[model samples]
Target chain A: MKYYGGCDAGSTYTKCAIVDETGKLVASVTSRSRINPVLSAQAALDEAVATLDDLKGAKDLAYLIGTGYGRNKVPFADENISEISCHAMGVHVVDPSVKSILDIGGQDVKGIAIDADGTVLNFAMNDKCSAGTGRFFEAMAHAFEMPLDEFSKLSLKAKNVIPITAQCTVFAESEVISLVGEGKPMDEIAAGIQLSVAKRCFVMAKKAAATDSIALTGGCAKNHGLKQAIERVLKIKVVDLPVDPQLMGALGAAEYARQKGLASAKA
Target chain B: MKDLKHLYYLENLLQDANNNLVREAQAGGRLAVGSVCSLIPEVLLSLPGCFPVRLRAPNTGSIDLGTYYMTSMSCECCRALLERAVEGGYKFLDCIIAPDACAQMNRCVENIDLLKLCDKEKFFISYSDVPMKSDETALRHYVKQMRIRVLEQLSGVYGVDVSDAALRAAVLGHNEACRLITAIGEYRKEDNPRITGYEFAVLCTATYCCPKDLLVDKLRETLDELGSRQPDSGKNFRARVVVAGSEIDNPDLIRLIEGSGALVVADRFCFGSLPGRQEIVLNDGEDVLLQICRQYLAWGKCARFMDTAKIEERQSYIDELAKSYHADGIIFEQQKFCDYWGYERALGSRVMRDDYGYPVLSVDLPYAVGTNAQLRTRVQAFVESIEIKNIQGKVTR
Candidate 1:
């Protein structure tokens, strides 16, 4: 059985996903991408390969594709595609009807519109600032003395929502502190922060002219509170995916490698 | 980035334009005329014994003194150029002919005179009005006023007689320089151009800062040097971009865009080499001044003109260029808070993307397109979108 591998070495984390010729995701692994992306990619793939009982070694893989901010830096990969295209491909593989994607990574946010075949039709990115990104939530979590994972859970229990006006992360952190001092409920502030992020993403997505059939991807997609905020702002139901949202880029990269390999073998 | 032989000489001329070339002419009893606008009649200024040097501030950093005189809310370009002048950068200029190119330039000239930035007695400063309307009557008025306000000053104050015969020769020299610069620009028409956008920008910027009489010869040698070189098809550029906006004298910006997998093939800007420099055609028995006035008026439209005809002319010019060059998209770049382009970017991006069916990236950049990571990431994603659109092969709605 032929197999292909894809690695997405993002700024915050690196994920590797392996798929067989039939497009079955056999193994997947994630690890923190510290200083060097190459090491993180290698470790993620190594862990996935080792844990999967039926998998063969590296030499058995037909093709290796890389994606993300450090996509080009992955020395062992056969090809490097942008994470935007990767996310579109990955989303289409799981839910072929998804015409758009919202990917909020640790450092940037992307609003992508895709065609029926998972090819990107149009896209917009917000890398200029950290206003409406995963890093902003991480910074807020650090300030509130809670784990980033608890932000969505805690915010969902709020009865009153207070808006966070500052867009800059540094200024917003201070604003959050002051809001806390004013004796406002922490859950309400968290709910307000998620809404503010959703509003920023809404404007960015509007720039691409994307309207409907959107699926959420990236590490931030796991936050249920942010998902509700996005659905409220866009006024549409976000598409559900079969696999982990963070694994989408890697899955897309592997899908591309598989398609390219099959086309070459036919030729 | 093929380093042509002329690049070295052009770099030296741009670095010390006032001292190396202009001063060499100044020492030989030739007057150096300072010009600020592309609409300025360069052929009239470059008389038999005068050197008409177009003004620009290269790689400018701080503008505290420039801001003190022009204030902080003014255009960045005006401040940068004024900063250099206040620091005694234009010591070689005998007279400054500041045309009312834009709103800020008129005030720049006013500040120069009010502050006596150059020598009060020795330097002769003059302002000539360029008509905003594109009509035969307006063109005629421009010709008449140029002769009275510009030619008369050269003869009366600077003692330089700009005769018809001398003006004809100057037009020929100007045309020769424009011809050679256009030749270098044509090399970029190839699928993978041997000349990168940054190199082309350098060659074009040299036309502004150096003596045209000398630039023509170096351009000829460079064009011949490029003859034996093969077309660069090995580079895997994601898209071909046409940079459209106001005054793009910054070669670093072009370098940054090209560095991000997009090759800049054509541009529509104020001081760029492509649309800015047009080959002047002077017919015998037709007044040379009238022909010069007509060509300068009918050339590329700057952002100041707001009429429907001028708007259509500018859009069609860039669209035709995009079609001919096989450009994949347009990058509309402007300096922050530029008054004219603040409107043009919105209108131009809409027209390019909606009417012409092209991908347009509108970015407001600082004058310095230095290593800003955010800007780089934005450009990278824009180019990637173009690449993916190509792969999709669908005309986006």
Candidate 2:
């Protein structure tokens, strides 16, 4: 009956995942990230705990692990782990067949190579650029005057893939505006944006030598259009996860808490 | 786990380019010769009346003005040095001896000279054409350049002795400090070394920034303290790594790596003790300058050495260090926008990991890594990966 917790305070949102001693996911919740990661973590965990009948509060969990960019600032976390390692473990737990992962988060992009046992073999990350990340998609979505989710889906209806040449987010946004002004189809422009991000991810994946099956994690994983584009670009299968892809980091942290808490108790 | 007695004092010495020791040397009528690259033989500058102080901009928070002048695309370290120069931080220098080894760094020195940052009446800057390939012809060029550019400037401008006897005397003092630093660095090879890498980096960096003669006694004492000092009982580090990279003047990068659970057992970067602190063997049969230039060319591992033999030698040098140090992996890092290291790190990391069969983590970091979470996470993940390889019995070593 013992429970464990994992909170991922990411750039754009805070996600919390809860699991039992056996590593069974009981509840998972997502909340908008606050200015302070500590508050964001507490709010997300409280929302997760509210979904379960047995838990009174986040304190009821036997152990809690904080992860992502704001990991060190999470005051209630018993431990902190990097989001890279967390994503590897979470994807491996959900699907052992995945050997590589492309995690496009709010502000950064990560290409991680993992082994069969959920150990990270190698990783490559974008260097201080927002071109091939969730932020890029959000900017494109804002220019299109639509919700982010609707913007991602619009790419599916594209009849032609227009090439977006700029490798910078600001320049690319300006290019998108010009394309819109030039009276290009909205779906094709959205398709170009997704494909541009997918191409950048491929270069990073090549750095890690990511071959075979890969999975998409982070908030951008919800974008089916981007997933298909990545599959096309990497020429590798993008495996499906039964759980929400955005909860992978939190789930991975929760799994670590369960394993470590049990090991501590036995010791 | 006990700190070295001189650790805090040495750390404070590196805070400013014009530190207490430099001031003391100046007060004692010694000239501070600014040096940029390891290509210029350090002993030649350490002649009787002058000392070599490797240019570094410690705690450089902003390089905006530097970027404005040098453009934002050059090496951050060079930009930071230029920034420090523009702020009149290097006004204490008598003359700067620069080499054409790196174009970006040369630009930094050129900017300093053009702007006349150092207002000392006799202040001058010498830019020499150093050879990249280490051959007999190149050695002759190196000797000639060091004589006309480095040696003649100090002797002519400040009347500092550059005689064979003076050079030999300088070598003796340099050798003494090198022996002490090398002896202290040997402890890192122990199963549980008495010294940490950050402590070693601080000690090593001080030898380069401060006058070598003044640090000899303290280094000797520190070496003695390490001989009997005991490490903490349990293993605090998860993995042992060799950090090979571009100029790492700041020790916080080492501190960050150690904080991420990897112990840096070997430092093969610029300003490190490996080749820089190795003693220069002398003989009565040869000219002191010729011998010194020959030894430095052999020790050249910088990526700027583009010859095929030197290129292969650089990778083998890292392999040799990893084996001798018993390191579990290698971290090949570079300063941002450094063209030489940008190519070298990409090729070297792969060659070490795939061809040499060692786990390698390649990264490009800023000039100063002050509580940088991104770099810390990269290092932590690398340590975990190495640990997992050990557990899985997949580690080749």
Candidate 3:
């Protein structure tokens, strides 16, 4: 019953996933990534481990790999692989045939073209722009004084979606407020916001030539409206992975740890 | 992986900016004249007792003050350099010779002048009107302008000899620096390069910090030290890459790119090997100043050109280097909000991918490095993509 740990200290959240040698998810945890990412990752891992019946702490793990933005910050990790590679690995494990990935994370959106074996063929990420990010949606939700889950659900209900085209999140938040003030329907504005994000993501998708068998990952993927908008624009079916999309990076890190541990064990 | 001796010496020279090389040269009774663009021929500055330093704001934290004069919409590189000028980073310079190379730079010079940022008695600026086009008429005007604007002015002001004999020595010394740098670049072409991209950047930047004669001597010594060493296989990379875009003085971004398992073997940009470190070929009886002006005009990599042929010619420079260096991909490193490169990168990426048949990773970032994690992810993905393609190609074959 060998096991490995994967830590993902991202911009907004720190997540850790522990898996058995057979690639079974043993336990997982997520929490806000504070100023100190190292502590956040450690705490997340500890909380996850505490839930396990047999395991007491990190010492029980065969290998602990790290991924995401603060991948190198996790002192306990054996190696730091980029979040891009992690995402590919996690998605490929779920559906090997999936060739394209659109991961709109907390800060930015990454459009990736990959092979069946989880190797990236091409990729593009937005620069200093939060038009198609979780933060953008969060800000919009904050403006509406509604829970993010409800706002996402409301977008799908819009029949006559009003077009709002502010690229910056700050500007778009204000635009959303102004639209609400002008008696524009909330569902319509939400739909427009989803459309805007979908459009922003497509530019990067085009760069990577991500046209088919798309896998939508990241925390933002949980939004049904945004997913449908991306599918409508791309004209491709977006598949949902077996594991929670938010855990993709951590899962990939665990997979890498498993592979590397096996190789080292053999040597 | 860390015991590269030559890199340590170069890193020391790169890290400490306070009177390490420039002021050391000034203490030797040599005038240190700083310039903005590589277009300012070294012969003009390196006469008898003068050192030419290209202004670079290394480890620049913020341009909050610089944006006050030039709006935040201006190019990050210009704003960074302008901020350093305002922050007294360039106060040690005798005269900052800014060229009217592009609009952003012109704005930077304008702001510096309007603000009267530096010590009036010790510091001054020579805004040379560089020729935009590569025509014969423009060439003549450029040569004349460079002579009057930089040559005659420096000679008159600094009280140095600008004779043909002095110019010839400057040419040879400049050529010597280029020769050594090109030799260093040639090492990168190796299957396992002894020099890393960061190390190469440090070596390239050393020319801008120290006198050519001093740099050439130091480079020669470093080459000798490097000659006895074997290439390290521990740092085996996934694919070889070429860095192409606007001027790259800082190696932090290059270090990040290299960290992603891509070995940067070639560079085609301002302040890079394509033109800057290319050996200067002095013709038989041709004027030294004219030859330099022609070289700078022909080899200009900035995106400010209106002429399509000139842009195509520069594009070929990248293609040829990529082909020659056997590059797997190109990283289009542009500073954020560079109006010229914004257009250039869009057009260039399309042409490079479609016509030239080379993959390009376009990155627009703040001038500083290690701040952006998204950038690292992109570079990593890019390398993985290139590697995956190679594997896919092999399987298909």
* TM-scores for chain B, listed for all candidates: 0.95, 0.99, 0.95
Interface RMSD of 3: 2.0
lDDT tens digits, residue span B4-92, model 1: 87777677676654847676677788888888877677778888888788877775778888889878777777777788888878766
lDDT of 3 by residue, A1-267 (tens): 788888988888888988888888888887889989889888998898898867778767788888888888886788778788888888887778788888888888887777667876667777577777999889989999999899888888799888887888899999999999999999999999999988888887786576675788888989889998888887878887888989888988888888888879899
DockQ of candidate 2 is 0.58
Deviation in Å, model 1, residue A13 alpha carbon = 3.4
Displacement of the residue B96 alpha carbon in candidate 1, Å: 5.0
- Please estimate how well model 1 matches the true structure, expressed as its whole-model Cα lDDT: 0.80
Best candidate, lDDT-wise? 2
The pairs that clash in candidate 3 are none
Q: How should the candidates be ordered by DockQ, best one leading?
A: 2, 3, 1
Q: How close is candidate 1 to the true structure, as a TM-score?
A: 0.87
C-alpha lDDT of residue A90 in model 3: 81
Better of 1 and 2 by TM-score: 2
Candidate 2 deviant stretches above 4 angstroms: A50-60, A175-184, A208-212
What does candidate 2's lDDT look like per residue over B145-199, in tens digits? Answer: 9999988988889888899999999999999999999999999998887899999
Note the residue pairs that clash in candidate 1. none
